[model samples]
Target: MSHPVVILGTGLAGFTLAREFRKLDKETPLVLVSRDHGGFYSKPMLSNALAGNKTPASLVMKDSDKMSAELGAATIHKGRTVAGIDTAARVIELDGGERIAYRDLVFAVGADPIRLPIEGDAADTVLSVNDLDDYGRFSERLDGVTSVAVLGAGLIGCEFANDLLSRGISPTVIDLAPRVLPRLLPDAASERLRSKLAEAGASFRFNVSVSRVDRAGAGLKLTLSDGSVLDAGLVLSAVGLRPRTGLAAEAGVRVNRGIVTDRLLSASAPHTHALGDCAEVDGHTLPYVMPIMQQARALAATLAGNATPVVYPPMPVIVKTPACPTVVCPPALDASGAWTVELTDDGCDARFHSGDGQLLGFALLGAATKQRQALVSQVPGLLV
Candidate 1:
């Protein structure tokens, strides 16, 4: 009997690759292993679900059984943890000593939320919504909560702040950076989004970091580096995410910022591959949905004996802050360019240009977002 194609996660990347691969090759036996319940849901919806009147259970589109049948998987190992991988033997050992052989292996384990070290007794009470279970806990804690202190004014932080406003909860967003989305937007565009969110009942503390969190009454008190204190019903940390590379690294797979995979999404080990937030494909670690879609399609074809390479077009990220309509396609980190911003009455359009005047990237807010398609076409592909 032929060994099954085994996938080590049930997140978007893992399930997506399975669906894409099944479309091309149905006879191949497939097995999916997950650390959670193995439900199908859009992860990006977790942030704005509250405003959409969506509950944790409602967010899940399909359960493990439904997914198993839909994908025609031989077995769906829900709530199972992989102890280790024997790459040489093409087998994965589960925590309970059960082992499963695989014709090919994939790691789509995603990433973990970065937790900050804060001094105080209540520091452990801080919450981060990284998955469905985490969102359920956060939702349960929101009862009777009037305000929240959000750490990090990055993409997730800003979106949550805007979503919280819809539930009549005021959010005080604190970030070490001078402006919100400092990495994604230029100064003018960042200011535009800041002002819009501020107008929608969101507060901001720039250039300051949270030093401590202490229990204050039924809520929490956060002390900032600038010696300021903020009191709120809850504290949320949305600083950033780090790839889950330990499993792959321990298995002798090359690991850098993420599991190092070639352009073909193949790991150092034979018949082992990785993608999504857990993979640094060709030196690019993009934890976004679009890249994962591209990776899934390309990898699916490759697994189907096509040997296709993933091609990435300019994918602009649409910020989920209803308070402000914004889109951004940031330039490469190593790209040498300068931003030219035009601030309008209702919005701002900022573009990053190379020395030769080629459009490298752009940020569009409010009315300026209407030009998203036009501007996106001008920007070069991230990976071609």
Candidate 2:
């Protein structure tokens, strides 16, 4: 029997790759291993779930068995961990000495939410929703919470804040940055969204970090670095995400910010590939759905003997804050560009232009976001 294609996760990347691979070659035996229940769910929806009234249980589209049948995977090994990989033998060992050989191995291990080192006993109680299980835990912890204190002012933080407000829970957002989404949106655009969210019952504390979270009667007391304090029934940490690379690194696969993969999504070891949040594809560690879609499709073709290189188009991220609708396509980190801003009371349209006056990136807020397709078309693809 031919060795199976063993995937190391059941997240969007792993399942999508399996499904796409089956579309081309249905007879290839596949196995998906996951640490959780191995349910098919949209991780992006967790941020705005409150507004949509989506429960954690309702978020699951399918369980492991159903996914196994649909994707033609021979087995979906739930609640298991890949202990080590032997590149020379081209096999992986699970916990308890169980070994499995594979014709190809794929890593879709995903990322973890970054937690700040804050003082006080209750700091461990702070929540960061990264998966369906984490969301379920958070939902259970929010039983009697009337106010939520959100740490971070980036995309996820702002979206959660807006969602909390829409769900009738007052949210206080704390960020170390000077402005909301400082890395993504310009000052004018950030301020516009800030104002709208504030009006919608979201409060902000810029250039401040939560130094401590302590028990205060029936609620939690958050002490800010600036000596200010706020009371909340729930504490949410949305600082950032760090890819799961320790396992791959221990197995001798080259890793940096993520498990490094080439244009074909192939890792350092032969017959091993990586995708989704765990993969830094040709130095691009994009945790978004768009890049994963491209990677999955390319990898599927490659596993089916086509060897297609992944190409990334101009992908703009649409912020899920209904308080102020926003879309942004940031210029590459190495690209030298200056932002040209057009700010208004209702909207802000900011464009990043190179010295040659070429449109490299842009941020559009409110009604200005309607020009997204037109602007995206003008910019070059991230990689081709």
Candidate 3:
């Protein structure tokens, strides 16, 4: 018998692809490998879990065994990382001296938190919420903590700050940029969100970067660029995520920003494909659930022997900060355009229009967020 269709990683990307494949072909040999507990859960809910009065265990939807049984696929929990891949032989070498053969392979390795190099014991004390396990650890440390210093003012950082506030914990957000959600929101919309968050009892440290984190007795002390220090009982790093492509790259797959793939989701190597956060499809890698779901369906058909090109419509990322209420469909990474702002007393809406007055993207906050679906329908397909 031929080797099974193997997928690496059990996150949203891997499980969604597995479910999609089973939808078309019920009996195809399928295998899923993951480093974590291999639970079914919405990763976005991690930040909001505490605010919803839920524990880490309560957040998980299903365990590895249940997920495998439901999807009719073999599950390998806590598999060793792929050391390398022999594309010519269709085999993957595990770090544990194990080899897995695959008739078709899908790389959904996902991403990891991007750690910043800094000095002092406080660096070791800083935590990140990237996965369920990480959230569990962070939640345990939240007990009896009064203040938190969150690094980065991006979407995740803002969401965490909001979550902390709802749990009666104060958070001071520090970002090198002048405004929050710099990549997603225009200046006017960002300002509106900043004001709303401020009213909600969140502090900001803009135009300042952390130089080092020193353990100051009972708390962590953050040294900023201006020779000032901020102390917090806990530190959360939400800077960014780095895609897991080292294995694919070592396997001789083309990697640029992420694992390179065509519209059909096939990598440079034969019978090997990549998707989700690990895939750079047509020069775009979306780390959101919307894009992962879109890619899963298209890749499933192609992997099941029916060739289909993945088509992505305009998908707006809804920031889960109920305090400020923001939604955004950021323009393409290299889009060249100027943003025009229309502000209201309780809200702001900014549109990213090209030089030709084409509506490319938009950011909506507060009452303006009601126009998300309407504005999204007017935008064109990204990364054609």
Candidate 4:
């Protein structure tokens, strides 16, 4: 019997690649393995799910059985963890010592939330929502909670803060950065978003980090680096995410910040590939939806005997905070540019321009977001 093409995840990356591959070659046997329940859901929605009144169960669009029928997968191994990979033999060893041979192997393991070290006995009580299971736990903890302490001011942190406010719960957002989304938006645009969220009952504590978390009656008390204490019903950590690369590294596949892959999404090992948050494709580790979609399409074609290289267009990220509509397309990390911002009564149009007068990137807030399509056309593709 011929070995089946095996995917080791059920997240957006793995399922998307399977769907795209099936479109080109439906006859090939396909199999998927997921550590969780193998359900299909929009992970990005988790940050803003409260405002939409969505529960963890409601967020799942399809279960493993339904997905198996739709994708025509030979098997969908739900709640099974891959213990290790045997690259030389092209086989994966499950947690219980079960081995499965594969014609080709793909890693879409995604990323893990970064946990910060804090002093105090209640430090371990901080919550983070990285997947559906995490969201479920967070949702259950929200019962009778009127206030939450969010330990980040980045995209996910800000989105959750806004979501909390929409549900009439106050959120105190703490961050080490001076302003929100410091890495993604200009100072002016960041201030605009902060002001809007503040108006919606969101509190900000910038230039400070959470030093400790202690129990305070029925809630939690957080001590900041600035020697200030804040009390809240819950503490949430949204610091950031780190790509999961331990499995690839153990299997002797080249690993960097993520699982290193070439433009064709091929790992260093034969017949092995990776994509999505777990992959660093040609030195780029983009954890956004657009890049993953592009990678899935290209990798699917390559796996289907077409050998296509992935190309990326100018992709803009839309911030989910309804308090202030925002869109940002940050400039390249190594690009030399200065932001020129035009502040308006309701929003701001901030553009990063090169020294030679070229449009590099932009952050559009509120009404200025209407220029997204026009500006996107001007920005060059990330990879050609």
- Residue by residue across 24-96, what tens digits does model 4's lDDT show? 9888889899999998998999999998889999999998888998887558898999898998898999989
Candidate 2 error regions (>4 Å): none
Cα lDDT, all candidates: 0.93, 0.91, 0.88, 0.94
List the lowest-lDDT window of 10 residues for candidate 4: 69-78
How should the candidates be ordered by lDDT, best one leading? 4, 1, 2, 3
TM-score of 1: 0.99
Error of 1 at 305 (Å): 1.1
Clashes of each: 0, 0, 0, 0
Candidate 1: regions farther than 4 A off:
none
Q: lDDT at 100 for candidate 4?
A: 92
Clashing pairs in 3: none
lDDT of 1: 0.93
User: TM-scores across all candidates?
Assistant: 0.99, 0.98, 0.96, 0.99
lDDT (10s digit) by residue, model 1, range 135-235: 99998999999999999999999999999999999999999999999999988789889999999999999999999999988989899999999999999
Quality of model 4 by C-alpha lDDT: 0.94
| Model 3 CA RMSD to the hidden true structure, in angstroms | 1.4
Stretch of 10 with least lDDT, candidate 1: 66-75
With a 3 Å backbone cut-off (N, CA, C), the pairs that clash in candidate 4 are: none
